[model samples]
Target chain A: MDWNAFLLSLKLAGWTVAILLPLSVFIARHLAWRRYAGKAFVEAALALPLVLPPTVLGYYLLVGLGRASPIGQLYEGIFGGPLVFTFEGLLIASIIFNLPFAVQPMQRAFENISEEIRDAAACCGMTSWRKLWRIELPLAWPGLMTAFVLTFAHTIGEFGVVLMVGGSIPGETRTAAIAIYDRVQAFDNAAAGAMSALLLVISLIAIGIANLATSRAGARRG
Target chain B: MADRPTGLDARLVQDAPIPLNARLRCEPGEVLALVGPSGGGKSTILCAIAGLRNIAEGRISCNGSVWYDSEKRINVATRLRRVGFVFQSYALFPHLSALANVMEGLGSGRNGGSERRARELLELVRLGGLETRRPSELSGGQQQRVAVARALARDPEVLLLDEPFSSVDRATRQRLHRELGHLRGRLRMPIVLVTHDLEEAVQLGDRMSILHHGQTLQEGAPHDIMARPANREVARLIDLKNIFQARIAGQRPGAGITALAWGSTRLEAGYNRRFAVGDLVDWVIPSGSVILHRRRRPSRGIRENPVHGRVESMVRLGDTVIVAVKVDAHAGYPLFMSMPVHAAERNSVAPGERVGVSLVRSDIHIMPALQPDGHDDANADP
Candidate 1:
């Protein structure tokens, strides 16, 4: 296994988690607090990627980022090339594929917070923005971290989305999971086994760190 | 207390058309307890004055400044209104320490250090050492003290406490009550306390107002309210145990006369001009006002309003004995007469034994029956 692929996988997971954390918080707040028309529809749409086949998501991304499409045209116009079959396209696909993993836990966390606490903040005369930044976000930090971890781990282990959109571009888009698959396809069983072992260790350590952080937060709240 | 400004003077009207009008001028260092049942709009009144609720009609002016006015479309946000509010649930930030919670409202401009001011306020509430603890780490009483400290950090002109002691244990409630009494003495701001407990109202309020169905039924000093309720409902709310229907038999120049016709006995009572001849009126004799004797004794000063009865039941509460008397003369209901436990024990009175119940004419408060619309203007006085 190439060490570069492992490093690239780690970088991809890191970027995904960073971008998804704030987005998930915003989505959770909207789902939990705001009342809007078509909320149910919007929620269902956001969650569609969770159950839909990864190949389906990858296919949609491929077409959306292809030269003919608006997003693809904009990308090509800005960056001088199509986004399909590129590393950036692979990251986009993984984000979409893992969105539900990022959002669901956060939504549940925000839902469990009693409205009495929010009303208390309002009565304290804090503005909405201040309340969100100072009160709600701080209290909801553990759930946000959980969402980030799940999204990052899920993105790291993604194969189908990368295979379809990234086309196994070595050291660029071929993450560890995709590298293991390629090794297995080429009948390099020894290399595949080594990459699988590394992926397992990384994922286990990520999960352990996440659990420790969450438990510490829980103790503080308690 | 440097001639502190008058307290809350506000009228509130919600989307529901009935306007809740309140005009109060409490001196500095006064505790005004607003007592009412749930949904009587007691808390709503507090919110309106605190600028937390929008009023569709009328104005709210506190400390000589207009906080809100619907007609003029003038409204001040709650934070800018300079009023402190303590919620029933305390509303302390769970993530913040007790000191931090108190300091959160001190606004960045206070001359002294924020921590020092927070500590001073906490000390005022007797929670000086609990600064590092979170809300969940403290008992209900401690949490409420922190909330009170937080409210005081703003140095508000008016402090609004909504059932501040309701969530604490009885023992803690008594302690908080005493602490609150002390705090009221030290602070120059007027405090408006909302509660549904009559005893709490009496103990905490310098002057109390009783609200029913979104309208104030009566307002006055606690002793005055208990002794001279404006009507039967007010009497009932104050726990007047003996209410009897009587008819105005006749009217005299300075005092009117009425006959309280029970089943087989009739008692005479002195009334005022508010009573008309043949008018059906209800009168209340509070349990504390009833005197009970074991043997048939000669009538004393106000013997005209006297009746004989058998003790139907006896219930002991603290040091008082509440005895229910079966007055066969009163057709529909049995009369409840109360006696002190020591008096009952000295007289050796028990249930099913005969006793004489006597009340003074001054003890008999008579009023016209409640209107069919249930409109009792008992809260008009402050």
Candidate 2:
């Protein structure tokens, strides 16, 4: 509801998108192109956050970064504090919560590319890195943009993961979604209405921008 | 007939089986066509030579250096092979402009001047000013031309094309073939092309290797293969339609000839060195070489081989007429004879009418009967 909470939400969403954009592309490409041991199992594991209850995911994150945990101990040794109740921790949680949403669309996009194109590149003696940079990534831009926008919006709308891992630390962890909950709990219906409207407008504009970019790219290709 | 460095030498052996086991030695300026049916491993040989498919055994050498050797554990990656490949689908990068697609293979150091070379190659293929256009914006023929230009941009030691004309229209395909002929003259790279069209193979290949079931059936000039197939399979594949079961009726020692009898039709043929007096053999005569006449003419000074028949059916193909003539009282089988449409018109031959077909003794080729598999039918001597 407050401007600080709104700014914190924006920052969390921004960082999540920044980190996940490249990571999701890698994941999507891996799932789309390569054959490896236990690939289906890894893909299913990546998708668990989409189907599993957010609170359950939050509980697992809580256990994993609870100071005494191995990851929590590693973070504490590096950053001199526990990862729980920190902005970095919330960002990590939001990324985990929105990964499947980010990766699935991009994976589908990469899957649609004909094997003829890959074979053509191979025949041309282009290296794998060259093919990825010059061919695969460019063809998959629209899907990548879709993943970015959807992940950002999904991260902003998240509530359960933030409540469990973020701990509502005001300017640090109390995101807009969490702030709206707080305002509703305090019976400040007007503030909640205004925050919900802002979230709705942001999502609409993001979707419109993504559509425009995709159509422009498609037109250029045509 | 001048000897030059053979363009590519590839020997591929995989775990399953050596699907491609060939030693091709082509001159630097010659076009060697690898023609076969689908899944005959023609493309596999090309890929192995290009360093695209890994061979678990055998060795590949191009331009006097070894590119791949399974026993030595030496394999050059595709990028280092300096071989150009044009795929059947014309794998032009959809995201790149035509010029960029052609320039993608040029090294960064050569990037500045490669555009001119790209344009030149494009012009060579008759795709002059479409450099800025993407692949999707071009027609199928233009796309294939762009792909060809891209392959030639590196001026590779050997150029490989996999069904280069398979995706284009007939007019475009003919044009592409002419362009390929011109490029072959200019580049002087040993161009290895894989094609399923027999006519295209015969037209384009200076020398050809006919493959069947992953094995080379025969390799020679296209006309040589057509006129004198090594076996029955090659004869059938080359469209020799008059194959019949015959017995060695007799042999003429001084004339270096043998007599053969098929039903009531008797013919004299050149004596096959491998034939014995009592050996039963299959004789193949190309339909195109058989001359058809409506009425029997007076015997000439020398009558080599002649047969009387009734025209059973006539199938017109373009400018040629394939006439299936029934010899003797054969139940349903007919001997095929091909003649130009003008010849058929002059003779006024029609189905169910009596006609006489004549072939020289040199055209009467005899070989051993094919095994049950019929694998040898297409390669038989004609």
Candidate 3:
């Protein structure tokens, strides 16, 4: 059943969400609140990976992190391993691909909070951090939950970006999606069906729980 | 109580093309009610004092500490200003219970008795049992009370209320007014109440400042501001509905009555202004100060101010009846007189009936017609 590939896929998805969840919230809040020159350009650049073909994004990441690239050379000079065709490379690619998935919902949530409540919090002697933690976080909890679930599912279901960037090294970067493809190519129908069902079930459970949780929160907001 | 130190002065020019310049001070245990028309920079004054707004060129200080000074480049953060603010919308935290909302205002130094303090504040606002309920679970007035309790939790040095009772029903507003009056006695801070409601301002303020556009037209005791407004606009804003334009004919120096010419009609009013004899003057008498008598019967007091007219209309608002009378000699609109509904019934006054209404000699307040360069030069009172 290619157990190593399935475990690698799960590990990748878990790490991606754990790291991106908090980071995206900060990014979302900054995008929601602050205004500066070139803000629109920066936002559009960040969201490019969402609309770009996954393979195209993967190609850019490959070039950006290849041994010939400055970052790739710096990393190789430090660690003695090329950055491409590695698990770390896959993780980075996953985060970029899922950028908009994580940010948009959280940004929308922060924007929906009334300005009166924000001013009231400031008048109540709350620092910016305290106001965000106490007032904004609680009210935007639903959007945050949606962001987490969408990012988790998107990471797990990823195939094109990881395939191009990590080259599907078995037990290293050969995620469950690659394993299913390999199984089909080898005409191993039973094993392919089993892995596909596992991925399907995982995706379904993530989406189902997100819907249920956000619906309850939505009712409270209403 | 001793005098509370204050030097809160601001001359802001950035909100619009014209600068809003207002200076307000409240001694210890007093409220300076800032009454003005809507868009008259009343709330802006409160916000500027609280450091919630940036003033282009001015200084604001409270209790001898500077909150904002443009010359020194000192601007204190809003939270550290230590001012309690109550917004018109109540601005309660929808997620937090009433107790938590109040406790949140106590900040990090709340110590161990936060719960007790919050409960006591809620009890003070008459919301003891509702402390556990979230703002969404409370009524509008209840939420307003929670906002007040939360503002007071920090024990601020200055209190600013921005039309705090505007959103509630009239009955609830009256109750809130009484509660605010009770609260005013317990807290001796420099309190500022910003409202467009003239009656509310006259009732609650120990001292009243009348504003228009961006300038403070007059500031004095409520009775004085009402009885002797600075200009035609101020007279209209303070609810003196019987303002009329008359040309100054002569001044009776000793008796304090100015002989005024209203079209072809001659009148005597208590005016002390130094304006020239040929200058135009705007004068007002309180609706209640107007005496009404049958046309056949003579006016009891001074005969010069009496106008023989026909009753044009009568509007009954609660206990008072507003009678509009068209004078025989006046070329324009009718004069308005308000009296008790019982008095109207007793006098048997009705629309189209002939009557004699006398503008009380002592009740007449006069000011120069608003200048063309004045902020409110358009002079559309209605």
TM-score of each model, in listed order: 0.87, 0.91, 0.92
Q: Give the top-scoring candidate (TM-score).
A: 3
| Ranking of all candidate structures by their DockQ, best first | 3, 2, 1
List per-candidate RMSD values in Å.
4.5, 3.4, 3.1
> Cα lDDT for residue B180, model 3?
90
Q: lDDT winner among the candidates?
A: 3
B46-131 per-residue lDDT for model 2 (tens digits) = 87787766666788877777888888888888788888788888877887888888888563323558778777777887888888
Location of the lowest summed lDDT over 10 successive residues in candidate 3 chain B = B373-382
Across B1-382, the per-residue lDDT of candidate 3 in tens digits comes to: 8775553444455546445877667776788899988988888778777787787778888778888888899999999998888998988887778888999988754466988898899999999888788877888889889988988988988888899989999999999999999988898787888999989998999999998887788899999999988887888778777777777888888888788887788888775767779887777778888898644555456364777888888999999999988789875667889999998887789998888877788888778876533321222332
**Per-residue accuracy of model 2 over A23-91 as CA lDDT, tens digit each:** 998899889988899998999999999898989999999888888899999999999998999999988
> Candidate 2 DockQ category?
medium
DockQ, per-model, please?
0.41, 0.59, 0.67
* Error in Å for residue B47 of model 2: 2.7
Off by over 4 Å in 2: B1-6, B14-19, B109-111, B247-253, B261-265, B294-296, B299-302, B329-332, B345-348, B372-382
Error of 3 at B277 (Å): 2.4
Error of 1 at B149 (Å): 1.0
Which pairs in model 1 have colliding backbones? B216-B379, B217-B378, B217-B379, B218-B378, B218-B379, B262-B329, B263-B329, B263-B330, B264-B329
